[model samples]
Target: MPSADRGVFSLIIINKAGGLIYQREFQAGLRKLSTNDYLVLAGTFHGVHAITRSITPRIPNSQPPPSPATSSPGTAPAVSGYSYPNPGVAVTGIDYLETDKFRLTCFQTLTGTKFLLFTDPMTGNVDTIVQKIYELYADFVMKNPFYQTEMPVRCEAFDRHLGAWLRGRT
Candidate 1:
């Protein structure tokens, strides 16, 4: 299981366009931002991520060039660009994870799914916690017949299970 040391600061989810889809801060004493500001940040980040992906260089083909005499005549080659397993999202970057008091975990799903989990920077096995949260999201949010994609995640069961699991671990 992922670590649960109460060092988490916040989590943010961004859409393909960098719109702030979700933002939540868990730790105490951190400065709070208005909902509008958080949304702006999400959008800005999304734009930057897309720009970064476009700027990334494409890998060149590995095949050696054929000699003129042996070369096949006039076959067009497919052009490709630098590609990462995109998850249909522009970019998923974790800016801050380790600090004196907190750590951040960011997970992006294949359909541009994004999950950001914060924890104690010193906590061990944070991945486990992340996996469990993801599972809960899948079971409660994605699996629910009522959940609409790109909408705010508001399942009561999700909140309950998340609180229970975190409390238990802590």
Candidate 2:
């Protein structure tokens, strides 16, 4: 079992089609889940993320319109913008979900790949960690010629680099 101070518990990567691409447990803080259970969890989270994105309340455009030079022809922006917290940015589903035991931090790439990081509730700098994980994925997994798109990640380098990076964090 992992010590109480271990910050990260696990990481789950989901493809654009809601398939589980990669999953790793950094610390044995949580009970072990079966392979099927992990797949189901990935699918369920993907559905919930879609629902959350769809249901997010769009605030009306209260700010002034872009100037003539910036404004495109016949392309006025939506009256009700989808982005929350930022107007121009597109809506990515729930960024962080916190519970008494742990916090789930999600980071979605522009290509729709999602990184789900499970960390201790008290863990800080989760965003930075997620970003670094994404960078590692891009470098080790995506860059590998043998890697197929939207498939399970089997790259040894990705696994090695990710484990090393997480270990350095604690």
Q: Could you say which candidate leads in TM-score?
A: 2
Measured with C-alpha atoms, the lDDT of residue 73 in candidate 2 is 83
Please provide, for model 2 over 108-168, each residue's C-alpha lDDT reduced to its tens digit, 9 standing for 90 to 100.
9988999999998888799999999999999999999999999999999999999998888
Worst 10 residues of 1 by lDDT: 78-87
C-alpha lDDT (0 to 100) for residue 12 of candidate 2: 98
Candidate 2 stretches greater than 4 Å from native: 1-4, 61-85
Measured on C-alpha atoms, candidate 2 has an lDDT of 0.88
What does candidate 1's lDDT look like per residue over 1-170, in tens digits? 34443544566776544556556666567878899888876776566555655665544445655556665678655334334464364544553346675676666667766666767677767777777878888888789899888887777887787777766776
Q: Provide the lowest-lDDT 10-residue window in model 2.
A: 76-85
**What is the overall TM-score of model 2 with all chains considered together?**
0.84
Clashes of each: 10, 0
lDDT of all predictions, in order shown? 0.66, 0.88
